[model samples]
Target chain A: MNPCNHHSVSIKEMQKLCVSLVPIFNHLQPTEMEKIVHATRSASYQRGEQIYGAGDTSAQLFIVHRGLVKIFRLSESGREQLIRLLEPGDFMGELALFSGSPFDHFAVAMEQTELCVMTREDLNAFIEQHPKISLRIMEEFSRRLERAEKLISCLTSEATEQRIAAYLVELADEHAANSFTLPMSKKDIASYLGTTPETVSRKLAEFQENGWIEQSGQRNITLLDRYALQNL
Target chain B: MNPCNHHSVSIKEMQKLCVSLVPIFNHLQPTEMEKIVHATRSASYQRGEQIYGAGDTSAQLFIVHRGLVKIFRLSESGREQLIRLLEPGDFMGELALFSGSPFDHFAVAMEQTELCVMTREDLNAFIEQHPKISLRIMEEFSRRLERAEKLISCLTSEATEQRIAAYLVELADEHAANSFTLPMSKKDIASYLGTTPETVSRKLAEFQENGWIEQSGQRNITLLDRYALQNL
Candidate 1:
């Protein structure tokens, strides 16, 4: 499905949307934000479209304006190892902004997606002129490093059920609501947690039966007791 | 063993040493480096000393000048989830430099260690005055994030032996030599690779018997055939 065909937005509206969701630019003065908005271009991707791939020369920063994007690497055996899932207000392809290196993973649209992209050259120049913007970017990177470290810890020590529970808790916090929808399918969640779809299904069902969480549908989950879920 | 007692250096020498190892400082002009040198203080820790713990207020950035430091977190069952081991020229506690938050893991000396410490306020001020240094630090953080993501991929899709092979390849590349000493013990390697020491021991034996590598000691291995190991 071509999202742009169905829901078109003007260039000015696109710029405003881009400026509003990008955390680094949102805190800036109106003039500063306008400068960035002018530099950004909006693009759309169909579900399963590749935004970028491993070994590709990276020269743009992509901010999700709508829908979901999956960033992952393919293992030697052809299995997908999920690195991160970019939701609205989340950005990707940041390593290129500083390192000027080829991307080490592939980014694909998990659903029909719209994104605002700014060229690396432009962004770097702006950062040079505005050092505080660079500092804000650093804070974002620090948060990502912390999340990556936590995922590593989960993979190493936590059991499958515990990993799922922790992941749900993380999602709840990210969404700022105990009752929310899962962004990805159970199969994707299984891959993200380094397990199988069968296992993820079984675990979610077990949680439902145990009264720790209530599931209204396949994607809708409400945390009945966060403390108990955490203890798992 | 008291490394500082046995081999002492003056404050001037210590400051110069600290300035030399930190990548950001090394890139700055000598005068700028000197400013940082004056702000940093020298410290030492014995083997098995806890440098910091989870929930500890993080106020200083630590640059390892000598010996090894292990960053890890403990599960409720007391199982340790190893994060990363810091060697000479590598720094830690950087999240505090930007976020002003507590550390989420424990940092401990794996051996008699010497370090240079800079308070968060001083470092932030230095970064503000020298913006290029902030870019350099961003590059370092980017490299770390790349490594952590690769580790996550290894944990998910690689078998135990494959993971060991991949880690050895990484170590070889880092040292710029096919033959080098492993910085950590077998138990530590097991923890880092998400496996057991027994499994690590068995895998090394299989590799040795297959003529893929030569093990001189528990901590020294020569990669006899890089082509063969890469295919594993």
Candidate 2:
């Protein structure tokens, strides 16, 4: 699939869409946001497209204007471990820019995704000129570190059932409703929770049998017992 | 232990000692560094002292000038999962400063440790005044995030023996020598690698039997064949 063919977005359109979408630039004046937009190039990725994979040396920041991205790393045996998901307003590739190191993970678009990209030199210069951006970047990093640490705790401490239950509850909370669509595939969920697809499916079924959740097909899940899931 | 009693050093002496210790402040001019020192309080922790733990509301940054610190999270069943260790020139508690979230893990002094402490508000004000500090903070965050991601990959994808092999290789690389003392305990290493103490002990012995390593007690290990471990 041609990622660009899916959405032929203009530079001005992307600038207006992404300037306010990016957390760092949202606080700035329109003129200042325009200055940052000038440094970026608009791009799109089709669903399941390999946006960038391991060993990519490009130090360009990919800011999600729309759609989803899954960042993951693979084992020597070709087993995947999902790192984290990036939604609209989230960005990736900052680490490579700072460390001058090749990316050790892969990023894939989960849906038709729109992005604004800026090169390392340009983004570094932008942060230098507007120091507030650096503060925002630090805050973003702190948030990500906290999340990564939480995942470590989950992978090490929590059981498979609890992991799935917690994820469902989290999604319900995010939606502020009992019913919500799954954000990622079961395989991806299994990878995210450090389990296999069969284990994920088994635990999910057990949750359903216990009346903690209701499922219509694989994606639509409604939480019937939030308290139980939370306790789990 | 009284954090201050172990270090009765004068404020001037502490300022001089710590001005060159913290990574963020080391590059600043001596006068500028002294300005930051004035904003910090000098404190010390005895061996095994609990510096901070989960749910602690204090939002003060702790910068280690000497000795060691360990960061970990506890499972619901009271099992400890070591996150990472902190040593000289390392700092903690910045997450609270940025997110206003209580710490979700525990931090302890592994030895009698001297530190410089700065409250979140003070550090925020300092960063505002010295914007380059924000850049440095971003760089530090990038480094830590990269580490956290690597750990996630290790815990999810690698087997226990492989994990042990990788850790040994890492420690060797850090020391730039074939022989080095283990910076942490086997139990702690197990927690860090998401395994058990018995498994860690077994793996080390296996590596020894394979002629890949030589060991005297648990603390000292010499890599006889770095290539074998690297290939492991």
Candidate 3:
């Protein structure tokens, strides 16, 4: 499955779509955004495609324009830990943009996905020519760093249940609704939460039994009582 | 006792001294480096002086022009963990600069010290005007991030004794010249290693008994057998 084919959008349409979708480009003058949009190459990956893996040379920064991408690492025992999920408008590979080292994790397509790719060197050149754009990029980097630190702090300090609740609330916020499809499978969610799939299943069942949430299927989850869920 | 006073240098000269000492500034063009030197302020701190504490709003990026500084944090029980020690060219405050958060850890003067301080906002503005400068700064941040990720991996995978040995080798690589004094006390080292002071003492004794290392007084450690130490 290819997102480009599924969406049936032409390259020109995709370029326009890219400019409208990414907030980072919104701050730029239309001319500058057009230059970037013209430079960006759109690519599609099928579900489970390895977009890039750990130790891959840091070459391109990727912005997800459609579908989902999971950034993760494999433990020695072959257990996967998802560090972050990239959605539409979300960028990955900034770490590579700054560092010349190989990537530390793998980014896999969680669904048929469309991405706009830009080389780090070209991006740096663009930034050098546009100080205001550079500042905006720095601001974006700062926000990501803060989020990573907060996640680290939570991982070190919060209980498993609290972390799960926090994850659900975060998912809800991202989707901007009381209900949405789980973007990844339970196993992936477990890895992201640093727990077992069984634990995630058990917790979801408990939340349902407690009337905090309702599940219509394996993927569909609705916060039946958000206030109660929050308190939990 | 203040290092600046001990050296009989004026504040302006002290700041000039740091401009030449720090490697991160070495890449700057001579005129730009001179501008930075002129803008920086020099300050002195006595041993045990708190340069900045965890949770304090970070205002300045600090470079240790002379003497030593220790970046550390306190555990829940008030135990101090020395995270990193700064030598002449070393700097701190990048985390706060990029994250816009309070200092995540405290920096204390390990000895009477002279420091070069620049306002974070001023530095950010300077970087905005000079994207090349920003690139260099990002390079520095990348190095720190690499070190941090490596430390995290070691903590998660290595045994306690292996960690101690690895830490000693790291210190030796950075500071020791055949022999060098431990910058912080055993208690601080223990906390940094996530162990007790008694355990640190015991481990040192064990290393000495095993002919892996030799200790002279409580401060100087000599790696008698580097291969054996590495194997451990």
Worst 10 residues of 3 chain B by lDDT: B1-10
Q: Note the Cα lDDT for every prediction shown.
A: 0.80, 0.81, 0.70
TM-score (chain B) for model 2? 0.92
Which stretches in model 1 have alpha-carbon errors above 4 Å? A1-15, A37-39, A175-177, B1-15
Models sorted by lDDT, best on top: 2, 1, 3
Query: Using Cα atoms with residue i matched to residue i, what is each candidate's TM-score against the true structure?
Result: 0.89, 0.91, 0.71
Instruction: Estimate the overall C-alpha local distance difference test score of candidate 2.
Output: 0.81
lDDT of 3 by residue, A85-182 (tens): 88888787766666667887789898988888777777778778775565555556555554654454444344557678778887899899989888
Candidate 1 DockQ category? Answer: medium
What is the number of residue pairs that collide in model 3? 0
Regions of model 3 farther than 4 Å from truth: A1-17, A20-26, A75-82, A87-90, A94-99, A143-232, B1-15, B20-22, B75-83, B88-90, B94-101, B156-186, B193-232
Give the chain B TM-score achieved by candidate 1: 0.87
State the displacement of the C-alpha of residue A225, model 1, in Å, after optimal TM-score superposition: 4.4
Better by TM-score, candidate 3 or 1? 1
